[model samples]
Target: MRCFVTGAAGFIGSNLVDRLLAAGHEVVGYDNFSTGQRSFLEGAGRSAGFTLVEGDLLNPDVLRPAVAGCDIVFHLAANADVRFGTHHPFKDIEQNLIATFNVLEAMRAHGIKKIAFSSTGSVYGEAAVIPTPEDAPFPIQTSLYGNSKVAAEGLISSYCEGFGFQGFIFRFVSILGERYTHGHVFDFYNKLRNDPSSLEVLGNGKQRKSYLYVQDCIDAILIAVERADAKINIFNLGQNEYCEVNQSIGWICDRLGVSPKLSYTGGERGWIGDNPLIFLDCSRIRALGWTPKLSIRDGVVNTLEYLMANPWVLDARG
Candidate 1:
């Protein structure tokens, strides 16, 4: 198979690139390196089957040609700054929503019939339902990042219906594993390293969240692409259970062998678009015989270990 993956130098995209190459598939990687790290693609660069293209999705002239002759499109690139969406209101619209439209157009022009998108569980906002299902009704959107993803999902579905394309949209919980650059784990680790004596936490630190390991996430995506053939196939990729923010903090602190004084920002949400709880009912993906191996605690610990080993990522992100 020939696969074209956007955000190929990013956390999940780089992992997926290596996985595809290991499975004997040819991959064309696309990224502009805004938040992506070239160091993450070190392994993929050694593969004869992997080709990296430095380009932006907003530029169709470059993106269209780069996507030519691809069997499938994995659209994983986006502005993931969910915490600061209000800072730059148009960042999500330009980078996520508009960029997704460009990818679809490029696919359409090249007659590419299949696409897999990285949607987020954030789209559910503060849902009334616990362990939110794929079919759960969406509440009013709280963040620009989630709003853009919801709109992108709609665009992909429409393309599938009108152009006979197959779309696989995976709504993921907070993903963790090797090569993790951003997110709560990274933030906490960075803070602890600087000041081992104390750590300032956002909100009340009781926000319940579910997380899936990166490899597990890639496995679920590949399985769905191979077995599920629907016009628009949507799946929630996450662990069945969740952990509190405070629980994750404990794991990180334990691993680092440091007990930091904790201070709270005093709110349920860490940011404007932050959801206090996000536990996805992944029965849809589980029905396809896929289950994540790592628990939320394991995921958090592993992420911290990776960051500890590769302290360069901290500098790169900064």
Candidate 2:
């Protein structure tokens, strides 16, 4: 199968690209390097079946050509930062909502039928249930980033109904693993590496969320695309276990061999529009014969090891 993956230079997108290439599929990678790293895609480009297109999803000309001749489109490009949306709300809307419009238009023009969208767990917005299901009500988003994702999901569903395309929406939880650029774990590790004595957490260290390894996320995408028979299939992609912020901080400290003083900025939500507790019920996806392989502690240790070896976190700070 020929696949066109947006944000293909990003952590999860690049990982998926590698998996597809390994499985003997031709992959055209589309990325503008907005938040994605070039090194991630460069490593995958070494493979014979991978092609990289330097382009933005906001531009129809770029998207149309990049998506041409692709059997499946994995739309992962977006303004993924939660805090950034607080300061620059329009940035999220433009990158996520407007960019998705361009992708849909391009797909419609080219008659591309299948799209595996990278939605967010933020769309659930402080779920009343511990493990929120796909049927859970989507409240009005607290952050513009979440709202933009909700809008994008709606657009994809509209396209699926109106244009006869298959749309797979995977609302992802906290994703941590190789090639990760930003997140709570990365922030915690960087703080400890710089000042091991005092660690400044963004919020009160009580916020709880589910963490999923990048491999598991990619696996869910593959499973959804292969088995989805619905016109619009939505799945919550996350680990079954939930980890508190302080617990995750302790895990990082233990892995780094540092006993740091923990400080907090005071609040349940780490940042504006940040959901305090996010635990997704992934039984919907698990019922499809896919389950997360790495536990929370295992995933954190693996990420810490990767950070130590690659030194991307140090470079990211500098």
TM-score for all predictions? 0.99, 0.97
Give per-residue CA lDDT, model 1, range 91-117, as digits (tens): 999998999999999999999999999
Deviation (Å) of 41 in candidate 2: 1.9
In the order shown, the candidates' Cα RMSDs to the true structure are: 0.6, 1.2
Clashes in each model (backbone N, CA, C under 3 Å)? 0, 0
- Candidate 1: regions farther than 4 A off: none
lDDT of 1 at 70: 97
| Residue 132, model 2, lDDT | 91
lDDT of 1 at 186: 98
* Residue pairs of candidate 1 with colliding backbone atoms: none
Looking at candidate 1, the ten consecutive residues that score lowest on lDDT are 291-300
